[model samples]
Target: MASNRPAPEAPFIPAQRETETFGYGDHRTDEGPWEEWNPTEDSVRPVRGRHRVAKQRGGLARSSTVLGVGVIAAVGAGGMASAHTGKPPVSLSMPDLPSVGSLFDDSSASDAARATTPTLSKVGVTSADSDRSGNAGEALRNRIMAQAEQQQSKADSKATAAALADAEKQSAAAAAKAQKEAAAKAAAAKEKAEAAAKKKAEEERLAALAKEYKLPVVSYTITGTFGQPGSMWSSGYHTGLDFAAPTGTLIKAIHSGTITQAGWAGAYGYRTVLTLDDGTELWFCHQSSIGVSVGQKVSTGDVIGRVGATGNVTGPHLHLEVHPNGQATGIDPAPWLRDKGLNP
Candidate 1:
């Protein structure tokens, strides 16, 4: 290392006197006026103000002190350079005596040489600072990338969750729809089964009634149904079921009944009324002749009268009417006969 302390000044030495004169011999005249003398600071004449030594150029005066300091700095810097560069330090030596002109030369040459030299410590500091800067930049980039990835992951998770929710909703709706359709089908099937059961029960009842009743006339064609509308009838509608047959078709009792009346009616000629055990009156009109008398009890299938086309009639047919409980107003006889197992 170089010290910052100032360099020591060089010692002053007086110029040496010539021992012998140039043209004179070694011996001197004893009687001459010359004397033996030595030069001293006070004895020499001083230069005047304008005659003083001029100041040197290029930063500092040319002197042994400045030269010494520059040499010390150069040696220290060279040694450090050698250590860092893996090279051997160059040896530097000083001469025992040097020329005065060499020591007093311009200092500009030395400054230019020092300025061009490179220092190991300065380069090392710069390299270390650059490494630190690069590392900091890399760290910042990594943090930014991590944040971006986190955000993307969150977005993907949200999208997936939304899709799953939608799918669940659709699935639930489909399940509900299927359940409703199945329930509807079950109800319709139940209704159809109930209707079939009702029809079966009705057929069974009719079958049982068929064994207890008989039709009034055999081999007869139904010509007019009850409630047939026409101008020919006085009531504006036919009041009885008309059975067309030959003039002498035999009429039989529909059920076990008593003959209540056997006489001629105005519009229904030769009408015969048979009263059942329940007071239901059955009238057999347009009869050619009455076979059973009033107040006579007859069983089913017993002969009652003969079918004929009588009063207010255009053909040979038997008109049958029914009155519940002997009411004067008659009801349609077709359904009444069906109740007794007869499809008239």
Candidate 2:
């Protein structure tokens, strides 16, 4: 019926159908009136177009992964730059495809330049540290020297004290010795003075005694002694000492005494007797003349009589006799007079 309308277009379909993709192989085995199907030149045109489209999609996905890794490296480089410059991290971004080569190349050149350059310190203190160390050493030396000086001073002080003590001891000993010597000298001088005083006293006593006593007669010759035998007396021995002298020789009294008898006796003619305070009687027999009276007091060296041969005598002489207690017997008058401090 020759419809006057345009024909409908065919719906588009993919060249690789779903059924064809799921099948295991492209070759089929069936008894049919068909030859082995081979790819035609016209049929290969669609397959080439599909392969090109797949290659484009795969390349776009791999490029996106590479861009993400590049963005991470850019962020790390920015953090490192912030640390070195002491600033905040710069905002990081993925570089445009056209500018990636130029941006990464410039960042590498800056890192190499930083590695070559040397850093400098702004506030310098090297000289100050050196000076401080030297001062510390000097201080230590000074302290050591001070300690040594203190020890030496202590030793010197001890030595001085010892020397002073020794000197004091010596001085004390010397003083003691001097005192002892002085005492000895004083004692010797006192002893000498005592001896001199004793000698002087003895001389004074002797001088006084010499003035108190005297001898009985000046000079006389002894002829007949007491106890002489030769028919000289009636008693068969001479009874007294005979002082032979010239007639009228002065006869002195021997000591202070009283006259008891002044008369002539029988054999002793013109005799005189003198009695002392102690009752001793001195008889003067053979006297030429008698001058003292009876009961008369006479002193020593006084004239008592004159020497002569008046009694029964041979020649002129003075016969002296000593009788204790006025007894008839008598002792030698020479020793009796000598006992009274008279050497006669």
Candidate number of the best TM-score: 1
lDDT of each: 0.73, 0.66
Model 1 agreement with the true structure over 1-344: per-residue lDDT tens digits = 44233322333344344565322345333212222234355434343432333232221333444445645766676577567555556444322222222344457754554455443233223344457558867988999999999999999999999999999999999999999999999999999999999888888888877766899987989999888999998889988889999999999998888999998998898999999999999999998999989899999889999999877899899999999999988998888888777887
Q: Pairs clashing in candidate 2?
A: none
List candidate 2 segments past 4 Å from native.
1-216
lDDT by residue for model 2 over 1-344, one digit each (tens)? 33222222223332333344111244222111122223344433443222221222223333444445655655566566557646555444321133222222347764665454332221122354446547867887999999999999999999999999999999999999999999988888888888888877756754553354344345688899889987758999999888888888888887788999998887887898989888999888888999999999998778888887886989988888999999989998777765554556
Candidate 1 structure, TM-score to reference: 0.55
Candidate with maximal lDDT: 1
- Model 2, residue 124: displacement in angstroms? 90
Candidate 1 local Cα displacement, residue 264, angstroms: 3.0
- Model 1 lDDT, full chain set: 0.73
Model 1 spans > 4 angstroms off: 1-133, 229-232, 255-261, 275-280, 291-303, 324-331, 335-341
